[model samples]
Target: MTSLVSTSHLQLAAFALGTVGWILCTFSMGMVEWRVWHVDNTTVISSGIAWVGIWKVCFISYLHISPGYKEQFCHKFSGYDSFIPREIYVAQGLLLIAMFVGLVGLTATVFALRNVYMGIAHKTLITRFFLVGGLCYIFAGLCVLIPVSWNFYSVAQNQSISFPPSYYMPTSPAAQDAGAAIPIGIVAVILLLLSGTFSLSYRFPVATNTTVNPDGINLPSAVSEQEQSQEIRTTSRVIL
Candidate 1:
């Protein structure tokens, strides 16, 4: 009997992890909390906290003229703002690229996994897809890793960005910390890395149909008895 082709459980696990990582990556990209700054004055800013992200900066504050109610305000980053730090600017570009690459990686993994479960005969092509997917995932993880590390270093040093006066934010935060997005991105990167390693582990299993001869040598069960006897006779003639 021919050996049965089957899906790799490791790659299936990899696909699950990569899918979760991709979702988290998307969330991290949109989240406006790469870094959080806490300020002393809550009278002007109700929340007394400011959020800075690759895409925008936001804070909750009372309307200056009508001070009874508070509202959240956000400023979207635009071309060439001196106030925005270079690290954030760099993160914007790199994270976007990472998201795209991760998407490609997920697509490739899906195709490979589907083909495997469907028992497609094109094993070589499926393996190539898995390799490409794994490489894409690793590259994507590295891309996110750069920005996450850069931002982490900045946070450890209490890096601050200057806001315009009209924004009503303090010149600098009393305290700053890395935000939810940073940790989320970090975890997502880890998952993607693991997924890449797992995806690369695809291998075909050896055939299970074998029997031990009287001499204790293992022989494939598919070998005909007539062929085995003929081989044994030939070997005996050679020995004589």
Candidate 2:
């Protein structure tokens, strides 16, 4: 006999967390503040603050040409730019892959939950979907976690990056710190991990097909139990 299992509340919570995490991950990736630099140089680009991300670098000068005028500029990382650090390059690639994988996991989770709630598929098949989605979410979280941790470590070690003349960024900064994006990415990874764990916790409920006849006579084996289950499910839906 087939049985339709209701979706678990924990799975719903996992989906919500995973969705939020994926969005935050994408936001962090696009933000150009992975690392912050403050420059005190007065000769060129005076009172400048720079933001370096995996994809690009941006700079803002409060007192560049005139005290009343503010200057802001950004430069994208070129494919052949050797000046970019290894960690940043790795972050760029890994974060992109993470976004793609997270998207896939989110899609899988949606479909799996829909199937379970609607009783569109057998519990075994739906469970497989949940497992795949959970694995994908975990893998994506790991991919992003590696880059975020690596870059954060580099910042802690006082890493520096050289900029071309056009970018007008100082090779060294008076003060350097990890930017907002770093913490955001870390939080996103944590959420994704929790989501995957919760999703994986889902288990199928036990089912039994044994039916006793009131006449103390066994039902004929020629009658399919699955058909009866389907008929009962249809009748229940109609009554509801």
Please tell me which predicted candidate would have the highest TM-score against the true structure.
1
Model 1 spans with C-alpha error above 4 angstroms? 1-7, 64-70, 206-240
In angstroms, the error of model 1 at 2 is 8.8
Pairs in clash, predicted candidate 1: none
**Model 2 agreement with the true structure over 131-239: per-residue lDDT tens digits:** 8889988998998899999999988887778888777787877778999999999999999999899889988765544555666876655568798689889999999
What are the Cα lDDT values of the candidates?
A: 0.83, 0.83
Q: Residue 111 lDDT in model 1?
A: 88
Give RMSD to native, each candidate: 4.4, 9.2
Q: Model 2 segments beyond 4 Å from truth?
A: 1-7, 62-70, 209-240
Give the per-residue lDDT of model 1 (tens digit) for 126-218. Answer: 888889888888888888888889998988888767788766778789889999999999999999999999889887555458899989999
Candidate 2 worst ten-residue window by lDDT = 60-69
